[model samples]
Target: MASESTTEDHSAVKKPNGFPPLLSKKFGITDIKQDAVKWNKEWEAAIASLTAADVLKEISQKLDDSFFTPQHMELFHKSLRSLQTNVAEILSNLLNNGHFDTIWLLLNAAEQRKHILEGLKRASEDPSTIWGPDCRALCPEVTVSNFLSQSGKGFIDFLTRVAEIFGSPITPAFLPNSWWEQASNLPNPWWGQASDVSPQRQISQSTKLVFEVATITRNQFIGEWQFVLSSAFSIVSDITNRGEGMKEVLHFMENTKGHVARCLAEVKTTFRDKPIIRCENCTKTPDDIGQNVRFMVCSVCKTKLKFEVHYCSQSCQKEHWSVHKKACGKKKVTRGLSGTKGDFLWAFSDSDPVANLMRNLPKKEGRLTLRDIGVNPCNGKRSPAAERQAKMLEADKDVDYFLFTASGEPVRFVIDDLGAKMIFRINRGMIMTQPTDTTGVNAIGEYMLKLMSNYPGLSRDIIIKQLCEEYGEDIAEKIVELEQMAYSSDLLTVRCSVA
Candidate 1:
């Protein structure tokens, strides 16, 4: 709160709604600075006294309350401006000290206040007349510039650091929906309503700034595409599994998918005109070897072929053919074999579990990834079964399974007879099964299957303990021996770790 004398002095300068006047020509710089300092100190005190819960409660109140007078709007602007200044100061200190978590919280709070302001602006009569001037007065650019200048950082540099901390692009995803849309309608802080400023000049400067930021941001995001996509997918999967905030999470996923698509498009475009310097298959450079290697472009991208791939050797080209064939000439391919079938399989094998699992289980047409068994790699709404499967897969990263099909379609399988048998059922009326011994092997297999069916990522030690409790120690040890043998022989692809 400002001093009584100061408040009284501003009384005569009040608007029709009895609120203090805007920071226009009527208010002197001295008065504005004094009031801003007072308000900023008050805001700091208020924030310090309250917990996160209290801040959230206040935000909720602001969001729910519809009837805000001009006085309320003016007070809100003052508070927001004060908060922004404090946030900037805190952010500068945090950045200097490398306290990223605190910085994230501050930025998140600033974003929430931005949303609250937008909500107020939207609820007002003639939004342009009511909140437009206030928005221009607030001038986010001032806060941005002050923080960046104090921190001795440029916008791109600041954003890059933010991206590294957040593990995502520093885009509107960090803010609420409609933030950019609302900002676009607001006045540019750099080029205000000055008589000397032309509309064309304003547009040109704004466009240049937008383009510069967008280009750098996009490039940075592209460089971290693997991490960006992986982290986004993980977030989406976790949210879906929790079964909370479905609508909001889905909306976010949709936006993220668009970003991923854009990044991929940029990658493709970047490669389009560039000379091939390395083997696409092995990712090796000619400099790695003594001789300059000749490269073979994909025949598809060339006149002779329909696939887009390059290799330093004919053997490498031939080796990648099975996976590449499925994606040749298609607009997009969701999954491609990363290497030779054996290489792909070997990556998942500390033992021959995959090979053994394939041998014991019935052979079926088509490849199956975790997705085929109900795990989803992308985000959004998922079936309850899919959600469960995803949770199971996430619980353990030590094990992985994938099935490849000639047709590039998913293969589905079900465990039958309580692990005594596994049925591979395909659409083409094909079935395969591995017989289990009636006494020792059958019971252990059944138990193992049931345990894994419910909890795919359960630890091996837990399973062994459960087996010991159910059967005798001798039988449990025997089962473990057999399991290890099966895994070693590639007859079961359950355990990915080496014994």
Candidate 2:
């Protein structure tokens, strides 16, 4: 558990508004920190202000309407309408009976919801300060609840009400017979089990339980939507399952999947770190390998890059060398794609496929040097090149760039734009190193030179100067001559064609 000081620190640093207005209205409380007497008073007052229709409105608004299509939303609304009787009964039960167990559950649910909003609020404030599971460890007021455990039958128990509300819309597989497993399997306080504790203790436990359940459900809910959509799509994609308008069904589901993906993508920015620190090479944590082993950090990347890249063993490090060498100890820049709204991933622009081909195409040498072919070579300053590449990228918004390996294998570099940041990624063949040497003259140099000259102030002297410093005076002069020749050839071709 986190100490009293840590909990206080979180509360102190969080928003001063106490709680979000929408959340406060939903929970039927003015403040989350209230004691049993104050909380009950506020709760009763808030509930009294609502009619049965108001209760239904609150319940229906649980899931965002904009996220679903009209068709899908109609289905959801159908399910919600069917559950109106149940909603009324629950509301009546709450107003009349107001059982201790139900109140406890409701209180915990509200707490959980508040915690998520707080975390997201923090993330929106300072994105670079990590806010995921590892950072979450610093504040321990919120312990995980067994009711939401997916490995065991515990998660099934948490879904009991959700299952009730959605009813027949939920697939049988979503709630299998295995879901009937005994609640005793739950390690945390099962529903109604709080009766054993005194009223004072119950209130205290409710506050703590709210944090725990909120964290679990927040993380789980954000992560599960894609899985749910994928699972449904997979079931419907089968040939044997084909029916009339199956194509339309697949199309609708596919669009919904994209909508769900975009929503999850937004949620992902709130928490981007892995739950545990894992080996960058093998991707296994110390716990997975055993107590006898420990993870090692890349000393070069640590000292030079100031970024810790881990490996479980010497072998994994060596195996990953071919891939890691590209970005190892190289300077990287953090650019905000979404302004101040979300989280972002780090991207490397050490090599530009276009600029690389331009520099190497003019080479008269038999085999291309690493630098000529856009490999960092890990010998010279690479940040300048990265800076230049960043500028080059800004001039164009094209996301897809096609390039060929020395082996003539085609590969693509894609710019993946998250709401928070942009990531330069390769779909496949990332491990295949750039060509060392190849036969024949690639006339593509002329087109490349034409493109490179477009950059402001990139005169012959400037290109010559930059190249001379990076390579040598000899190679630099040769490249400038090639550029001149290529330009003259282009003019000549145009004249001949015109004649």
Candidate 3:
């Protein structure tokens, strides 16, 4: 506590309620050097007659004679241990596990605080603290109000808001440097008003006893608050600084990324579990079906033709056969270059023989090389034709594989290192069907379906619609027609086996 003279000097300075007075103009706000000098002189005078032995004896007597019983000390220790356990559990669940909701609350605390204040105000008829526009920036109202409201969530919200404002753990500096001196001068009516009776006159009465009890309670609260805050600050500082070269920060960021990835995976799984397209007969989307009703596509089209024509049930497909028969065997429509310029499509799928061949390339106890896939290495700087081949071969070093078009133009199949995305670009000339190898041509058409599977975020039908803009839908329909014949053969074999 500041001396009575120093406190009286500062009491004269006045400022608006909930606002601080200017440090220089304020009467009680003395320089740190002046405070240090005065404190040193007072301290020396007080301790001049007290030797080290006398000080130790006084302290020992106070400790032994104190009213705090052994039971009270045990309870105090138990309370501290309980606090530690609770704090550890909270950190493990929220911080260590990287809870999304908790991270969101921390990042959006400033914006969230507005709604929190509004909700708290709405919950109570009249808030105890003054939440004037100027005072709203302070957190004591939020902290006090939340605790009084008896809501665990409200307290967490208040703590998050406080953390955001402080940018660190709470410390002694949370209060102004001269808080003790300014306490008596507070604008609050209860604090500012002086008692009329003298302490000497009231000493014999119940008023004295009440005053002593209030003083003891205040001192005990201050001691507990200081201990908790200091212990927390120390622990946080140690853990944060334990790692070298900002490793802890990096580790925390990695954990956050992992948490976000898990959240995304869960969302993706939810979507993948549902049907990708609507029912062909009723034109009803997945949402239209009952929860227990499974969405299905035409098995004849899917298994044999690798085409998907969706439906909610077999009955709908059967009823719509008359209309669907006209285009039942048609391939899914595809568009050309719908994405950003130079954004090549990933020309790969489980059905594509080339993709399967590339994926299964031999890795005989080590990294697979070009020789393992039967491709000869380019030796560069031969004839003009050889040199041209050499450049393409050099490019192949970075890519997964290449497939040549009917016009002999090479399409590069590159895999992204970071994102693991497969992409392909046709260097020149359009892919067309040839009499010798129509299989290769059909593979390109299959890539359109692959694009839909690869980028699930985009609608499958929408991708087909866009693909139709570049490559006519007839190419797909032709493949579907061929697939129908193949499916008929498979059906005949199955029936023969049954017979």
> Could you say which candidate leads in TM-score?
1
Tens-digit lDDT string for candidate 1 (443-490): 333334334434434545545543343333454556544343221122
TM-score of 1: 0.23
Task: List the candidate 1 regions with Cα displacement exceeding 4 Å.
Answer: 1-282, 285-296, 299-302, 311-499
Candidate 3, residues 189-234: lDDT per residue as tens digits?
2212335533542112112222222122222221222222222223
Tens digits of per-residue lDDT for model 2, 96-117: 3212112112122233233333
| Candidate 3 TM-score over all chains jointly | 0.20
Which residue pairs overlap in candidate 3's backbone?
331-476, 334-467, 334-468, 335-466, 335-467, 335-468
Alpha-carbon TM-score of each model against the true structure: 0.23, 0.22, 0.20
| Candidate 1 lDDT score at position 322 | 86
lDDT of each: 0.32, 0.33, 0.33
Alpha-carbon shift of residue 2 in model 2 (angstroms): 31
Q: Which regions in candidate 3 have their CA more than 4 angstroms from the true location?
A: 1-88, 101-111, 118-499
